[model samples]
Structures are given as C-alpha cells and as structure tokens.
Target: MAGPEVTVVIPTVGRPSLAAALAAIGPGPEVIVVDDRRDARTPLPVPDGVRVLATGGRGPAAARNAGWRAATTPWVVFLDDDVVPAPGWAGALARDLGGLPGHVAGSQGRIRVPLPPGRPPTDEERNTAGLATARWATADMAYRRRALEAVGGFDERFPRAYREDSDLALRVRRAGFTLVRGERVTVHPVRDDGFWASLRRQRGNADDALMRRLHGPGWRAASGAPPGRLSRHVLTTLCGLFAAALTAMGAHRRRAGRAAARIAGLAWLALTAEFAWARIAPGPRTPGEILRMAVTSVLIPPAACAYRLGAEVALRTGGAR
Candidate 1:
C-alpha cells in the first residue's frame, strides 16, 4: 500500500535533527510540520509541499492538535523531530493499520534507542534509552482521525509532552478503542544535553500528579507504565526532613531526642546513599557527571515531593474549566 492513507504530523522545537528526520521518511504521504518554537529566533525551513504551522510557543500537545486537525487523511501519523524512521516505514505503518477492527483506535510504532558504546550509559542516557520499552510514547504513533476527534484531541491542560500522550491513550481506551503495537520502527537517538537535563526533567513530577488526578490511581497500570517509585521518593524526603528536625532537637536535649535523632539520621543516610549510588554506578563518572548526579539525586526527591504537592492543591482548587 502507498502512504496516502497517512499524513505525517511532526510537532517540533527548532532541533537540527528535524532535517534528518524528514530525509529518512519516504516521499509519499503529506507531511505537516508544526513549529512549536514560540519565538521567531530559529525558523524551520519547510520542505517543498510540506505545510508549516506555528503554535506561537504553545507546547507540543497543542501543536499536535493543530497538525492532525489540518490533515484530511483517514490516518494521522505523528513523529517526533528527533526520531529517524526505518526504511520502508511508510509501508510498515500502512500495514499496521491495514486490518485493524473499527474498535481499534491507534497503533504505536516500535521505538529503538541506541546506546553509547564502550563505557556504560550515564543515568540520563539510561533514562532516555528506556523509551524503547515505553508504551504509547508517540515518538511514532498513528490514529484513525475519527477516533481522535471522538476524544476531543489531546487535553491542552497537560501543558507539556510528558504524560500527555499517555493521557490521550487512556481516554481512547476508556472510549472503547484498543491500541496495538505496530510493526513500523523508529530509532530515538539518546540526547546529550549536558548535566542539567535530568534535573530539569523533574518538572514532569507535576504532570505525573495531574495524570493521577485525571485518570485516577490506576492510570499507570492502565496505560502500561511501571508503578514507579514516587512513594519511595516521598519516604526518602520525609526521612531527611525528620533527621534535620531531630538534629536541632538533639542539640537542646539529652536522652530520647539523641536516640531518635540517631535512628532518623541513619535512615536518611541509608536512603540518600542508595539514591546516590544508583545514579553513580551506571554513570560515565566524569568529574562533571559525578557532580551532577550527586546534586540532582539530592534534589530530585525533594523536588518530586514539592511538585506533586503543588499539583494536588492547584488541580483540586480548579484553575479553570
């Protein structure tokens, strides 16, 4: 089958990788590139015949919505600018949707993350590579246009790309459509954005909390995500706080405060050490990498706890309809 049934929608910030991404895709279906860069600083040069739309600094969820709505094809295929499609990807995508039942809403492409050679990957690299096993990641995914409209597109309230795709998947499933794994393959190359990327990624903690609010506690299992260690992060942060408070009390008191402080101090040390080593072991162990891991590990638990707490209060109070 030709690729006419599908229109490729790429929502991108001004990454140089977009050119290579377009190059790997065979010329058959129409491609719509959504420029998510709000500023005019870096303009994406569009290929001939490809349509370009600007979301004016709105995040990816809105950009994707714009792309698919503009498409007239029966199937709307989404690709991230950073991914490279395998040869014959167009046909593979067509085949993936060729025989699906009417109740099937979408097909997710298989993602391959290539790892660095020689030394083990750093914590950040390993995290990026985990996308290979991630479900409904939308690095490459296709949806029947009808099913997409049925759900009112993605929730713009997501405000970021992190859990937005998963939220859409869950809604599709709840609406009686099943999502299947497709045969199409795309390679998601690991990003090397220096030391601070992982720390910055902690912002997703608020998104995670929003997901729980929208989809309920079962959202992770329903969407095929791991249950995660939010509980453990909370425990770690609480232990550290208790240890700090006990240390202050121990200075003023003698017997009970000292024993309790010792216990809390040991617990905090053990948790923090475990967290640090989990990061340090898989690392490249460069001076910069080591320093980054130590700082982020200390910061991540508290940050996760804070963001989640903030999200809970904000969502419950109802910012907008």
Candidate 2:
C-alpha cells in the first residue's frame, strides 16, 4: 500500500514571520497558506509550488477549516504562521503518521518556546512558554482528514486563537478517536506583542464562557487547562465596581455609603495587589515589567469579567434576542 500523504495548513494574517515559517518548511509535503486578512486586495506573496487560500478574515478556526476541506490528502497538519518546523520536519511528520491505526485520529507535535538567555523570562515570555505543554495546540498538530471530517473541523465560533483546539480534541475523543503525541517538534518563537498583550489576552475569557456553555463547568479539567481564576476575577471586579459606586453615591451625604465604600475599596486594592504579585513573583522584576504587571493586574479582572459576562449573556440569549 502507498504511504500516507500529508498536507500542511498554516493560517496567516500577513505577518512577516510567515516568510520564515514557509522557508523553514522547505518544499515538502504540499503546503497551503490560508490568508485570513479580511480586507486583502491582493494575494499574499508566496513562492511557486506553495498554495494560498483566503478565508476573508475569518479567525484561525475558519481558516484551518478552509484549508483542510480543500486538501485531498488523507492527513492534514495545522501549523501556526509564526512557528518554525524543525529540520527534516516533512520526513518526521511522515514517520509520525505512517503506521497510525484507524482509531488513531490525530498526532500532536512537541512545541518549544525559546526565551531570552541569561535571565528569568518576562511575564509575556512566560505566557508564551505555556504553549510548550499546551494540549492539542494547533501550533503544530496533525489530524487525519477523515477524522477532521467526522468531527466537523474546528469550531469557528471561537473567533480567537484560544481554546478551540482543546474543544476539538474533546469532541474527537468523545467520537471514539485517539490522539497521540508525536516525535516531530516545532519551535514557537516568542514575539513581542507590545506591553498590553497580557491585558488584551483577557478577551479570551469570552471564549471560555462559550466553552463552559458547550462543555459545562468541568471544561477546564477536560480540556487539560489549569484551574482558572474566573471566580476570583468576578469577585475582584464586583468589589471595584461597588467601591466606585459607593464612593460616587457617598458624595450625596450617605453616611453608610462612606463606610461601605472604604471596605470595598480596600478589598479591591488587596485583590489587585495579590494578583499583581502573583504575576511579578515568577518574572524578571525590572521596573518596566513591574509597572506593566501592576497596571494590567488592576485592569485584567474587570476586563475578564466583562468579557465572560457578555459572552454568557449572549450564549443564553442566542446572541440576537
């Protein structure tokens, strides 16, 4: 019988790193780059023998769906546009999938995140490092085309680069398919996404809400994610809002409001300080890092709670009514 053939699918938003990613793959195992830029008027510049598809700015889930559905090979591998495949990756991928039994639906590649040398990593670097042990991160994962078809590919409702892979893995497993770790490795370089990246990442809490609605409260354990701090965030956010409300109302001569405001204000400050310390404790404690953590820590709880609340309300109301 002929050996199993594989196609590589990378979803991109026109990042400059796509060029290096393509170069590292080096011309084996048919490659498809999905351009997810919503307003692209021109095609992405790719070398000959590489195919590019457009998903019109849909998120990674939709982009990957477009790529895999267009593939004819039995196996479709999903790679992030910023990751560099290890040398001889094509052959390693072949080896990883060559003898998989029918019940085995997917193979995951090991991920390595390179941090700065000679010092502990910054908070942002540490966040990126989490991908190294992330379960079923599509940064470097392969799935049998039939298996993908069976589970209906990624859930596009995720709308962001978080939690979709875990959701898919859960569904595939529930469908009686087994996913295994493979020897193939990929390097996920930590790109500096500016100072507010951590705060910005709180947007993923919305997806977590969707995950909860779809998979129930045990979704975190089932998806291999560490226990979350949503409950704490909710409390922190409530305290902050209550503090502000009471303080504002106190200006109208409400004696009880003044005392309650002090208590809520103290609670908010204590929670925010603890959250900041937790992040700063394990990171490089330079002045800049400390400032970033302190500022973002105060802001993250409210942002997370807002996103989660918005998503939950939307889910419960069918998002329209």
Q: Using lDDT, give the best candidate's number.
A: 2
**lDDT per residue (tens digit) for residues 38-72 in model 2:** 98788788888998999898899999999999999
What are the models' TM-scores?
A: 0.93, 0.96
Instruction: TM-score for candidate 1, please give it.
Output: 0.93
Cα deviation at 290, candidate 1, in Å, is: 3.3
In model 2, which residue pairs have backbone atoms overlapping below 3 Å? none
Clashing pairs in 1: 38-57
lDDT of each: 0.86, 0.90
lDDT of 2: 0.90
